[model samples]
Target: MASESSSSSSSSPASPASSSSFLTEPSPPHSPSLDATTSSNIDIPVLISGAGPTGLMAGLLLAKMGIRSRIIERDMAPTPDSRAVGTHARTIEILKLTDKAVYEEVGSQSWRSESMRFYFGNSLVADIKPKPSNDSEFHVPWMLAQTETVKILTDAYEKTGMGKVERGWELLDTKVVEQEQEQVEHQQAEDGTTQDVKTTTRTTSWVETTMRRAIEGTNKRKGESVVLGTVDMAGEDEDKDYEVKVVRSEYLIASDGGRSTVRHRLNIPFPGRTRDYNFILFDGHVETDLSTSHITFINGDNRHSVGMFPIRDNRVRMMLDDGTLTQEQFNAREPKTPTKEYFEKLLEETLGTLKLKVLSYNWLTYYRVNERRAAEFTHKRRIFLAGDSAHCHSPAGGQGMNTGLQDSYNLAWKIALVLNGTAPQSLLDSYNEERIPIADEIIKFSAKTLDNGVYQGWLSSNMKRMMLSIVPFLVRYLPNGRSRPPFSMLGLRYHENSVNKAHKSQHYPVTGPASIGQRAPDDILVPFTAPADTSVPRSEYLAELEEDLTDQPIPTRLYELLAFPGVFHILVFAADRLAKEKDFDCCLVKDVDHYQRIWSSRWPGLRGVLESNATSEAMMCKKMKSTPQFMVHVISSATPSSFESDPNETTTTALADREAGFGKVYIDCEGGRLHERYGFAGVSTKKAGGGIVVLRPDTHIGFRVSNVESAAWVEVDEYFGSILVN
Candidate 1:
């Protein structure tokens, strides 16, 4: 998909006669199905407005969680314009977890930045190189056009067996409705006949949306703006020209850009100040004396600045800010649609002594910067505002699309669990609690970056440039040594809530420092069971196993093991073996047993626990599914062979295997390196030495306890009980 559209002023006007012709026309190819557009309504699990990156991601996530969704877009095709040009590390991580193949495809086509170069009057000021991400393989932002991102997400969503995006559809009106429903139950009699047992009345809440699509060969308004309060006959004719469709959905996700009609319809107050900064942006091929390998920011006379960000090949995204407009003109600023030649001259003027020439161009856009966020992200617990609908800010850090993608990542799972009856509706509150703060942070960070970008003879701007020059040296002194910048979004953490618990709840001193609400840190681990190769000799395989696996060149990461969708993963850090001990329980076997039994029995129907009396061998032969709510993995500092106790003393417990009810076993065989990373370095062989870490569906550290005692296990159960349904 092309990420550039024609100038904003190129929209064609419409006549009244064309608008009323819809009455006699057939449904167009992009219109919704006839049944869907008729008087009768179509029911869906989730309805998404706008098929942009955020909406498409929400659809994909819901599908991964076993829920279906319908995405509707007003545009007949994906917008040629790309409002966002890159995705940060956090967004890429979410995409990788959602679908690895899609992540690889996007990453392969994106351009990775090497560094950022700042210049004042053609004199280089700062050349800052990006630091690698400590927690993820994707360290920097992957510079890809937003149109390409939407295309990839759309393809992934369709492959989920969910329906495709319903194009040429506009949300006409939407509101929450309550209706009384009648449900009947039947019972089987002794004669093997069905009998009506009971009838019940229940009140259900749903979002009822009225959708509209202009009938082809009619006055569809083209791209002309239509005022609702106008008295023109053409407006009246256009009003009733489109086909009306009714949609009933349990939830609605509005990702429909900054001019969100849904947000306006809901009367949600969008509060923020619009800056006086106006700029013209475009993507094109450029021949220049300066290097294109890095993102370059140039400041010229009269406060003019130009930013050149390399895309692919020789093309670059040029953002030129003249900074010449007066306060009053900026206050009443409208979009400026100048020709390609105009932008070329402006770029040369901003470049000063630096020579550059534009050989070809894609598209250009002119607008002032506006930083705004909706007062509320959710309404009535049924309607949600995501992406640009929730917040909009300057694209200083290339954070517009990345932040929106993370918003969907945070929202989709909560909605899925609630709809599946596994979690309570109150869980939905955390979406707002967790994401609004992140949005605020992004808004503030981007505003600061924009304000301090160009020199313009401002002391503050020059000072900031000087500070940026030494960022590489300054980061080395900070904790974690600046693997990723804060704008890359790896440093954001959620505040303590029902979902993100505080460490003080646990009396044990297990979790070192404090990371309960932060991203679950990553480390290397040796799997207890290695990948098998039949061609290899048994002796060679045995030899390889005997060697320290963690010392091998390529080690498995903890994130790879927690990549399962919509499930909570519990990591039990069981420390080393004690030769004096008779059994290999590591003082955690009883705790693990109680955790397994309670999880398997508590929410039988809700957890999707498959009841089986068959032996472990039979279960393995049948390939039975694991419990949906929880997955447990035990990581021991001891090697697999260490679990075999001395037979001469006593054989009290079974070996650490699936049959022994210890979940899947993994080895932290790096001299407890992985254990120490989680603050279990010099643990005693008793119960207090090890701890439990719970990874939420989004891979954030939801909860942690110091010891594997019954009291700790009970607290873990209570954490789940607070958010999950009865």
Candidate 2:
């Protein structure tokens, strides 16, 4: 009840418990900054509907990219219930870039649980912890309530001047106000001639968004004053609270929940079933006989199917079946929000002698699980759907809120780039192409887990029962695949995606461990100290360094290099000292210069600017600023000693780091494990080694130049050339 987490479990356990275990986390800094934008000036670059995790996260991320967005919530405030509870690894990685405190706050307040125990009444059925620690930053998954997460995200978002959630607003109507199509304007001759002149004008497409104040009397309007109360001045029961405003924007994002008004208005079909099987979920103080550290699923052959977790403040979160409630009893609870008594009696009877007393209930919900997905995610490339609007499913794996946040993430960068005029408009289309299949996968996965009552279906309880007897045996031979990278979503791929250029000669197989389209793993790096020079500003030299990171076996992490302003990250994993020296002499030195020469010097016409005879330093610097900025992280297998020893090596590395804008140099000299992990199998001097890996702003790999040669740089040039204007 105190924390927020979208809870997920690895085992189905003949029960769909949605319970989350959490430690008491410190509350967010006490409203350090109040929301400044109280005016109803909804005119912004991006307007986000539904201020849930998806919308809040979208607004925050867009702000990081210097894009301002107005997030509108139909409700007056954040959700009181613990909606989602599990913060997976990839999500934690993403949050660390935005604000490390969120990651730390969420992690501290939640229990890190790997295995969940299942019992049939008092009898033990299976104790299963399918996933194990791998390359993830956090070894085990952290569990915080979803509400706490919302507060952290919301506070962090509000702190950014970009936008804040206008809690009293709701989407009333949306339409294509303008379309980017040619229109012919006909004008009669001034002399009244028989012929008329015509001019063709091209109009850029945009959406006209109309939103009304759903909640009464809490909005500050900018332009015209509308009715402020539910009752009008006449008191004739007219809907006086309906204050509507129509604003136009280049794009609109619908992060609205399952019954998304934006999705409905766009005519996107959401096809799925609302299962008859209903469940009662409640969070309250429970005196129970269970471990306080882990999630337990008390389940079995349709007898006592329940899930219990120890949450913050000595309270517990529990979920169980509807327990044969009559249709009359079910319908009695108006709005489907359950009563406290409905859950107390059920918990008492189910626990029997286990001693579970629900002293007080914080929130109660009766939900009929539904698995559905929108047929498409975007409309006319102007209006986009995300979060529950795009895809919704039974909360089996806690993928709902997490996936929604990810949807906002995947689309945010593309929108930023396209709007920045660096990327082609077609880049926006990849959001649908990539996310739909992922939604489909989760929907199928959720259905099987929800119907775990009898074990006949996939993820059959029977299979778990049999596997339980030999779990230790299974763990030995099995790759521990279930709870590993794939389960945590760190292994998600978009290699077959149109936006990715990974199938070329140099790029490794997308299926490889750290290949194209996969979440780039975090690796440790040792800092190389340059010669003490009072002239060089050390803090500003490694200026891109993040403020939040603390102690470690190494100084910085690979993921930290990623959380910058929205753009591509080109990591040139140069080989060892001698090899890098050779590689630098061969071509690494000219990579940035080549792009600069092509984009700035020769191709000024690409930017639609007239060729200038004025080529001063300031003029060239201004011209260079216009091109797409891709951060270059040159990670080498060499140690600081190498650069300290060789003058040529020092000069090359320094030139790349400072003069050429190749990012900070990081060392991974410990057997080059990071190099090997990224599919650069070996990078010794004798070996024909090293390659280039390109990562998107969202940290997904886009392409790789595996063949690290002088000529191989052209492939990279071609990759950016296709999508970027210059």
Candidate 3:
């Protein structure tokens, strides 16, 4: 086999490969971009294989956390077809929280689908809509083409100044290696000359990946550079040869679709089964008598069903189950054109009396439903499997792409923390512990949905019809009618782990609307007066607040404060009863001093390196580049009038003067909404008394304590201590 070494770093050579027939010695010269000092060498912190939504999202999250990553896509150009079109609510929340611009672009360009209508034999049965939740603003899915989603993420990632996706590059293999390396630093002397005066030896482990240029040239359309879309059918060059290269990186994330090369190369068994059912999906312009505003499902004779999803401007995606043959027979059949006549006939059979005319088409394909998952999400703690690489199942609920996007979101922050020395290497283990279970649940959920709705038998068909008949009523009146499983994905949560845990205090139980590992609910809050305006009398400021609240800086949402990247949001709720008690300072802002130190400590440079005995100021400067980890916010149950003239001047001393641990502080102005949502309203009356909640970087509740006293502060410190490093 022909291969090329990308790195000239003789000190840190590519790790030895596992015994495989594909392994071979270097043959071709290295590509200029892959050389040691350039793209693929030790300087790169992360190497992501697959530029699909998952891989692109991973790169974006890393960039948001102030870490740089390289993404390589095997395909030279994007496919014209929109493969996965349903971007779910939870995925929207993740995008909005991490990058608002990307979220806004998607919201504006995509179709927002909040309701779905189901019919049986031309008779409408159920019209279902998701219930809105106080925890998130998004309760509907965004129906955008996968191609468009990739373009948006690509644009946002490129704008970060990190770099663009390296298209046509394919990963062949990977192996983990450990070695001691020398880090050389050049310092300017008094003579105005640079000298390599500092050299440090550090032991590090990295994944050495073998990659190659599988294709060449950008896929352009009509002489315009195509940022994304399907491969150009007219640009075929079968005679071109390929070049191979090997590069070393600290971490490797595999998101290379269901048939992942990285998964196969590692010999990881994808244990699962493929069902006999076959599905035909096509996107096209269509004219129909049916309502095209929301997703619609029609069931006809022989248990056959078809789903229609609106794609903007008269375009609709049609999916139908083809029972003409088993999956095996369908796969073995001779190739046939998916002509308009053929699809029209298929829809006529599935739609019964309903009529639809296929005017034109862009893409069409067929596939068998396969349920599979890797045995391990991570290998050797250096290589990770994400998206379809880790697990895949039926696309019945339009959850495939959304699940993959979340997988990257879950893993990115942990990797960033570990790489930046903010968290221990052990922190990475939580990725598998948390995401694998979610993957398994999604797999089971989608499989059941496919069976009940599309590929149903006689018994299941009757049961599904009965269920569909009552769905409208249940959805309208039921308490949990809003966010259903596998749709909103709001209920997905991690179990207690190193980063997600309950308090060690035995005196009281941590009670809240959401558990320790669930999503933190969102609520409105009134911002504290600006430092300059804090001296204004309470009566004077109240009038300004009433007129043009926006100009006076109106209320803020809980998520708005939590959106800061890679930082733990500590919500300190000062309950009303506790605030009215004697020594209210002790109950409210007593531990603000301790939190300030912990918050400032996140930046290693500002704190002077907690464990550093650096020889010079330059050495100290390097450590200061570390990213901050925690942001503390104080929410009080007291009124806006309690601030100015109070004897303690708690708001002035703790908030306006010190910045409240360098984070925002707000008041629960809306009839104790924030307090009740966090289960802190009655906390003062409880045996243990509690009001502290810690939200992880991903917005899930990581930890909570019963009180904000000195002891509770210790518990909070220990919670962070479990995952973060000094």
True-vs-predicted CA distance for residue 473, candidate 3, Å: 2.9
Candidate 2, run of 10 with poorest lDDT: 13-22
What lDDT tens digits, residue by residue, belong to model 3 across residues 1-726?
122254222222222242223344322222212101112235367889989999999988888777788898877766677778788878988887778788889999899777898988888888887676545667778898898999999888888776479887767677776544456778999999998965644544556687756334522224322221222324433444445566666789999888776887788998988878766788888898987779999887746789899878878888887764675586477654355666678779888888888888887766577899999999877889999889888878888889999999889888877776667778888899999899898999998878777745678777887888887676667553234545778778888788888766433333435677777777656666543565676556644543322342435566766554566778888665333555655434557666657646653411111221112121112332433466677776655554444533534424533332244456675546678777676554333454788998888888887677777878887777677775
Candidate 3 has which clashing residue pairs, if any?
Answer: 78-229, 78-230, 79-229, 79-230, 80-230, 131-482, 605-624, 689-706, 690-706, 690-707
Better of 2 and 3 by lDDT: 3
List lDDT for all candidates, in order.
0.68, 0.62, 0.69
Q: How close is candidate 1 to the true structure, as a TM-score?
A: 0.81
Please report how far candidate 3 places residue 337 from its true position, in Å.
Answer: 5.7
Candidates 1 and 2, the one with greater TM-score: 1
Model 2, residue 147: distance off in Å is 2.2
Lowest-sum lDDT 10-residue window in model 1: 1-10
639, model 3: CA deviation in Å?
4.3
Q: Who wins the lDDT comparison? A: 3
TM-score, ranked from best to worst: 3, 1, 2
RMSD of each: 8.4, 12.7, 8.9
Question: What RMSD does model 1 have?
Answer: 8.4
